[model samples]
Target: MSDSTTSIKTFRYRLYPTRAQEAAMFETLRLTRTLYNAGLEQRREAYRKHGKTLSAYDQQKELTALKEACLEFSGVYSHVLQDVFDRLDKAYKAFFSRVKKGAKRAGFPRFKPATRWDSFKFKQCWNNAKNDWTACGKPVDDGRRISIPKIGNVKIKLHRPLEGKPKSLQIVLDVDQWYAVYTCEVPVQPLPTTGSSVGIDLGTTWFAVTSDGEFIENPRHLGRSLGKLRVQQRTVSRRKKGGNRRKKAVKQVAKTYRKVRRQRLDFQHKTARRLIHEHDLIAHENLQVGNMAQSNLARSILDAGWAGFLFQLAAKAESAGRRVIAVDPRYTSQRCHACGHTGKENRVNQASFRCVQCGHTANADHNAAKNILDRGTSTERGEPLGRAVPSGENGSGVSHAVA
Candidate 1:
């Protein structure tokens, strides 16, 4: 596909809506939830009785009938419900295809209501005229806005100028906060190619160590906020269940956790952007983040967000037209980067490493980073390398190092 046709990027903007707008959003969410659950029920019953799965086209056909049956509810075609049906049909089709290919576990789908639907709203398309977006349901004239269909004018933070044609827009709610996500079709502008390369080693103790001898210290956001979180948890635990005070306390705790997540994501995006911009070729170990999350140090491991970091890095590198290479991570830390000798005794402590054969000394993570860079460079040049061999000590498993 041409770059112009294939390139797309999503931008998220926070939303602040009036009380009336909030109510409308809640109604939209409620209708969508009902439609989704009903569709899910249809799929489940079909499988239970006839052992048949619905294809995307088939689900769409069924949904058309369902909508026709609900024509009396004028708002059923208000664009929001239509989008919900479209999404539900697409989801079932994808899920069944996965099951057929053994990519997912075989199971019937289930249905759930939208008790919390009042928390959000959505519309598929909208138009903008004179900085105001108009759609079917209601006309919004907020100066801070994005245009969408059927949903009319919606408010947005407008933090940055939009760069491309808006292809899709979604309004989402998290806790009591609202946000807008816009998927835009952007023209590809690949960065000028260069021969620069770098290797990275990710750790739980430190966020990341570069082959160039730079370390990104772990912020440990969760660890830092643990005391405050514990106090909130204690207060909630002491409240009577189902009481208004208990619910309020629960929301406060959830909001705190969400804040930590948001901060971590922001940090990852910045770090990934910096790395992709600095190097033409990047190399790092391909880590199994899921496996790491199950380890004894899972809390710290999750906090470092190795998987999220790699995901962001890879995505940004792709957009920038940079090469990201994953090489075997086995023995990268234990092996001597200078002498090509591998031994367990090389990593003498949490922060230090001393090669037994070459007697080269460096920080453990730094040494690992160098090895990762070497492996990536070799792989890019078509050199053969052995699979990662697990160190067996410190429960570290060797896997593909992703750049």
Candidate 2:
């Protein structure tokens, strides 16, 4: 094996800071949010009054004056403060780019409320030559504790071994918990080659149907927790505004949502791993899920989590040296895999499919999976990736070659 790094990945750990350290972390978030807003306001006023544009470098050059004006700003690391301006710059650039494209909603950057600003990042961390980490953040005492710039060493739960050199660190707050996420330049170890291939059909009623007749059932995690969420939401509404009771109720609702999100993510990761491990090449529809979710079946479509599943599948495939191909989804649902006949009437119902021309019948999703496989293989093998050709008299089953 060559001693070379292949990829970069992130590792997250739960942090348990002392009360004082917690206060310091919160202060860092608040100051960063304040700085972000101030920078945004300066740009807006500058543009409105003088018709001048302020670049990130211009704003960054004024950081010294800012620190002198506000004593609290000096407490945080200088690089961290620079990142706040960088974030605002990114937002403005995105806004202008969207406007140039004539987007309907050219989302202008808005002020972030205290509740929304939940994280701060340190851009630099590792030192390779000296084999030493910086003072702003470093793993302490064999990774059990981590030292922050303003805050002392905070206890950490190192769930997994850290790989590669740490590049940057982000301290995130979710609900009441603080997490330290480290992005690293890890070496990738690709799995052994698998000669297998499979095509998948994604649906709301079923999570996925493989070309080999494997049906992965949808868990409907969100639907299962929806009743509890309604109860928590009602509790929040009944509580008085700006009261501790209401805040607590709101947190409860957020916690429930987090639980459901976790469940869905867990399921997707596991399923993606299974497919990547078992197959050398995987194919699925290149669905426009965002557009699809705008219809009346939006709730059901979102609940299926097709986008997340596909993303996870792609990520895992990339890391494992596997192939994931997204084929056109045009007539996969209506086209008959047996005879190349295409018609809406072929879909007998949500679950069944019957070819009117050749009398071959199968599950609707299974037929779609087969067609997806054919499309993927045809494209991969340099053949015309088109609808299946009609075969024998009356358009009987047409055999197609695939590698």
Candidate 3:
């Protein structure tokens, strides 16, 4: 089987650390950042003076020397610092390769400061004594604790019991919050085929309309919380700039925004799981959300969350071994699915569609979903399909198919 068919799962652990532990973690981050910058400097000097390309091993050797030099500043070198250099080397090589292939825009790699050290890594190996699992860094006796090599045991809330052998572990710090990410290789039992398919039409008002006649109302999380958000923003603005009160107010606003984001993500994941469980194949429009978000109706467009919904749907489908097909949206709303009649007169309003030629009336979004389903099925059967047309194009509505 292809690597894509192999089952890999990720579990996130929220770390609860004492004040001293948090300080130590931050110090480790600084040490790693210092090592990374020193490695980058060595590469630049080597390139300029001797025209030598520094490999990861070469940078790692230099990192050891730099760590010794900074012994008085920090303590003994940690494996995390070496891991950071390895990651930077990999990133540099990938960037250059992409540039050479015209896949990435040309740009020079810049140095990262200690304040920006986001994450560090560890590896996991099977342990026979426990006959269960252990994280690469450290194994906590109590299930709630995780051990890292240099960093001692840290408490974590494992929301779910982990399954399978751990392959890698990453300790990431984001917005002053710490998270432990575990990547594992697990055996996946095949899900019983649902033998059903669905085509979804995404919109600004409703999150989605399914060909099966289901409507998922848009949560509008951002819009719903806008009033409170504005109040918080005003509070922050009114505070004396650079003062502790202003800083506290800013953090409060950040927390609110973060809550909304987390809620939206959770909702999307649950919705995707339900759809994936019910459908053998799923079809959705390949919306150019980035471009759409630039339009006058950007706020409403973002509220719809077309991109986020599609991303969740695609990921769930992949993990379930189901197919997700992207069909050109085009005139899906205006085209009559029953008669294949296409015209501007069909879509009478946002909520209603009536085919002028065939006199077939249906809900605007539902008709669009039916058209999407037809297109998806046709494409799966190896039929020729039209491509997507630009939004403002005249009567010619093209549609494109993608896997």
> Which candidate number maximizes TM-score?
2
Q: Write the per-residue lDDT of candidate 3 for residues 128-194, one digit (tens) a residue.
A: 5886555464457678788765567789898898766677788888666899888776665456898
Tens digits of per-residue lDDT, candidate 1, 26-111, equal 66677678777776777677789999975445655565566577753345444555565567666666667768766535444456
lDDT of 2 by residue, 1-403 (tens): 1133355667889999989999999999999999999999999999999999999889999999988998999999888889888889999998998798776677799999998899999888877678878875698888889988876799999999888778889999988899999987766668897778899999987999999999999989999999999999999999999999999999999898888888998999899999999988898999868667778989877888889999889877766667889998877888888877777778899999998878889999999999998888877777777854333354444433322
- TM-score head-to-head 2 vs 3, winner: 2
Ranking by TM-score: 2, 1, 3
TM-score of every model versus the real structure = 0.80, 0.86, 0.79
Which 10-residue window of candidate 2 scores lowest in summed lDDT? 394-403
All candidates: CA RMSD in angstroms? 5.3, 4.2, 4.7
Question: Which portions of model 1 miss their true places by more than 4 Å?
Answer: 1-6, 71-143, 385-403
Best to worst by lDDT, what's the order?
Answer: 2, 3, 1
Quote the RMSD, in angstroms, for model 2: 4.2
